[model samples]
Target: MNKISRKGFLKIAAAAAMSGVTAGALAACNAASSSTAASSGAAGSYTPGTYTGTAEGISSTVKVTMTFSDSAVTDVVVDTSGETASYGAAAAEELKNQLLNAGSDEIDGVSGSTITSDAVKKAAKSCFAQAKGEATVTSVQLPTGDETDWLGEEPDIDEAAITETVDTDIVIVGAGNGGMFAAAYAAAKGLNFRVIEQNGNVQDTRHWVGAVDGFGAQEQGIKMDRAKLLSEVSRYASGKCDQRVVKTWINESAEMIEFVRSIMEDKYGVKMIYTYGDEAKWPAENAEHNTDYMYPEIEYTYDRSSGAARNELLLQYIQELGYDVDFKTSLAKLEKNSDGRITGIIAQSTEDDHFIRYNANKGVLLACGGFPGNPYMMEQLDPLGTSVTTACSYSPSDKGYGIRAAMWAGANLDKEAAPMLFDRGVVAPGVDGGYVDSDTAFGGKAFPGTIRQYNPGTQPFLKVNRNGERFANESSPYNDIVYAAAHQPGRVYAQICDANILEDAKRFHTIGCSAQTRNAGEAYVQGKMDEAIAAGALFKCDTLEELADKLGFTGEAKDTFLATVDRYNELYDKQNDEDFGKPAYRLSAIRTAPFYGCWLGASLLTTEQGIAINEKGQALDNDNKPMPGLYITGDMSGSFFANNYPCLMAGVAMGRTLTFAMKAVKQMAGLE
Candidate 1:
């Protein structure tokens, strides 16, 4: 008998343990099987019995169960072994289904687990080959390609590869809500069109997002007053957003909503509901209060009624369109004829490493988002700003791929406009302080459930710097809080709130308590919290004096910090924010016992800079002229918002840009 090495034995033992089979039991079974196989091999015309073959470099084991009646390949069961939970299990199940139905080695790869699928295929092939006395094991390589494969690459113009080119009425990049709308509109007009997406799926972010609102006049039973939406967005934009863009969004908002509704109901067979709930009131009071500064008549919230269902439906609609929609492809380079006419796009597949030429018979629309995920881009855009990102709450793919593509194409850069950083409150549990999801702190005033609520608003808390002195209003906007934290020395400190406020927070928002408290929230509710703790947010002591000692505050500064808290509390109790003019509802004193402080780190939501585009959604060069054949939209295009974030009815800007791109396509194809 061959001796099994310790490493091999341990691996087998681990596999047996995971399968809920004792190591001794597995060893006995293996010994019996080996003896039976050896006896069978000794007989003439004897087929090899079932063998568990473990492949190298794959996370899973392949169980090859073979049954032979008269030794003529009667049945085969290829059960993938050693699969991880969730994704791996799903992949294994899919493999099993494929094997059962096909009874062949051919199998479709599972989405999001391509490597695992390949591993299974290889293992199954090896088992079958060994049974048939043929070579089955083979090496496989990981898939790769340029940006067009997964990051939405552009076309290669250096070579004349597109020989049989046909003009498309419109070429839209990205398959998000914006790109989808553009394609649908073009199709409705009986125009030739194609959409290019770097993602492997459509409506990628939308499918994962929890809720969305602020579409212009609701259509398909989604009813929002246009005038009200415009006012609300204008106020949120703080007089910095382009009025034309805002107006265009309002005018077409209802149409976009209606379009989405139609796609959900008619095509996808999914019902679309208002998100703010049935009462027509904003879902949360915070949304209402914030909107008061903009449009008082506009309800602050509406229930989409369902998130998961809506996404599934919307994706189905896009798939049904039958338009030339390419996925897992990226834009490599833009093509322009010497005449300066924007012509075609060069795309590459990340899986196959093949370049596909997509001739934009009309024009190419860019609907990529901002560059908040790019650290280098952030520094260039906001030299004075601290490095904080909010994309962690959203899509991991929201990297500045689009922006970089545009820049490489000589597109103009918008220096002033960028996404603002917002605070994500609540750090990882057991840590003194950490980063929190801005939404937890600012997501409608309702305490973001237990998993996120780290700080109470009414707490008599002082945001002290390393010097242990109070800075900025505790009641300031969430973004402001993040900014202060980022600018502070070491970019961290404790937020000293009194015990009474903590108790109230615990009572009202169960999740806001520390880990030490029962029913406490998760260590890190948001993706960025882990990152923030690495940056800073510490918690310390019960009394102001103790906290001061720990934080290294001494003498007059400590006294000043206490005095400031007292003065702020006096104003808070009186419901008079004379110092900061904070609203009465937000004013509250922190004069309670057993004070506690949680450290908070600042993180940003949007990028502060992006590619420059005009009101027409045309990408412009540094010379302020449109880059022929190129258009940009979403966060990728810049100069839309100034100092503050824009509130253009949710998905309005994207909808308008897509619509405009469709129109441009029509004009290019001489169909207009």
Candidate 2:
């Protein structure tokens, strides 16, 4: 095995690389050494049967099955379906070959997938133990159903042990969208603020920001009804959200849009355009939108060399204004005064593991994001949301550290979870959606057993569960079908469309980010579908029956699938859906020559539930009282969302994040 040198390990550990490896890495190394010692000379002799061993991977459990002969290992299979498709999953074949060649679990890790590679070696060691007929196997403990608290007790940091101390007007806990906005406005007001980010740079940015009646909307002659918008958002939250926060976004989002335009366009020379401008594409024949949903002209985009450059501009802008962000600094905890008022925070430097105290005279703003990246937090707070997901695209830095710190300081978190789920997780043949055995890394976990995306699922196509029965009104919002499928057998469903997909998708006219595939023309759509088919993420067949069989439908399932297709055709011909009340224009038939099918689960974007805050962006106590020097923004600030994301509003989450970030800065500066 290629073991890292002591110097190399120390260097990486100091840099905080490879998932916060310090004490954990030392423990893991010791465990591996002990396991190897226990199974020292048992490589040649083995029991001649197929043995399976499992370990937690980046997202899901990685299972290694080996068939052994009397003298040599014959066959080896490594299942990394739960990992990132291009990274860990793609490295499975190489890892398997390495294990077989070495005749043991001691093998070099794969490039770009160190976590999954380590997991594979760990699990392979277990298989070696089982082959030797050992009394006890060496394996990491998987989650048991008897677990109580994922969030344990808070840390006790001694003030005397602190290495350094600094005083500032404000302390920002992240450099993401919310943190950047807060920092920009803080610099504009000439506040001596200290911004710290755990990440090396700015996190990935979402493409568009939602607003209402901004300059873009004004130029496009679009005006939205504020009351109706508020009502629609409130309805999406099941009336559990605080309307005061919703109304704050609704009324101030336009101003936020204008302010961002001034900085991004006028100051930074970036051109911003309305997403639903005059050149926007919509179905020509059916021009009206569904009344049950709203597509307000509120989103705007900026031209950039890369997908994230527009957001990164904020950091550059802040730097130019004589403020710098301290990268590789993570929040330790929020400190409070004797009167029970938040005063400042203790932060740990990831570089050398030294603690530094930063006293904030004004307030501390936490924009470190929500807990989508933390499996323990997700499994605890958003069990159902995580249960139905099969993939995650959220930032790894979003581990709910900010929320937890506030909670330790007597902040209340929203009881309900509002996960931003999209219907795009593409799974292979036999994989299903639900929680899986996740890794013990601090980086984060992905939803297991899926690839990047299956964009075709975004269209209002004919969907059938594993039992091959239509289970939902396919014309509903993005996440509705995924949520409905949670009750199905495998917590999954298949989206079946035919050769007329090009024309049908055009007619479907899906709004928001889902429209990218359709707008890219037939060539792009077919290319993506062909790629998915090659990757085994999709199934293509000439007939509906063949497609059903290929998609794992058997016996009654195959019969029900064919029947469901026929019934859907009948609904298409009648131009009405009595079964699910789907709009006739969105109804697609599956009778074309070449048919396509793909099993889908939800792709989690982020969690919107966090420390509860008021309209002023002040972190609230259990009694709904504001904490004196604690503010929250981005996903770290909750009480504004519940259930699922309101996708119909375009980029409302991003809008609310930026809006509240600025609001928090103003309130902390006594301007609000």
Name the candidate that leads on TM-score.
Answer: 2
What lDDT is obtained when candidate 2 is compared to the true structure?
0.75
- For each candidate, what is the lDDT? 0.47, 0.75
Q: Give the range of the ten consecutive residues with the poorest summed lDDT in model 2.
A: 26-35
Let me know the TM-score candidate 1 reaches against the reference structure. 0.58
The residue-by-residue lDDT of candidate 1 on 323-395, one tens digit each, is: 5577766665566788776787666554443456677866787765565443334445563443332213334
Candidate 1: Cα lDDT at 497 = 59
Note each model's CA RMSD in angstroms: 14.5, 9.7
Candidate 2's displacement at residue 5, Å, is 27
| Residue-by-residue lDDT tens digits, candidate 2, 1-672 | 222221111211113332532111111211111111111234468666667666545655677876665456667779988777888899999998888788788899798888788768766766665666541322223211012444543455544447789899899888888988889888888888999887678777776889878887788787888888888888999998889988888888888888888888899788886776423433443343344575474688788653436558888888999998998877767899999878898777777667779999999999988877666688888889888898777775566767777887899999999999999887876777865654344433446754566777788899999888999888767889899988998898999998899899878888787887778788888887887788787988888878988999999989998999999999999988889887788898778888999888998889999788888888899999998999998987888889989886788999999889889888888886
TM-score of each prediction: 0.58, 0.79
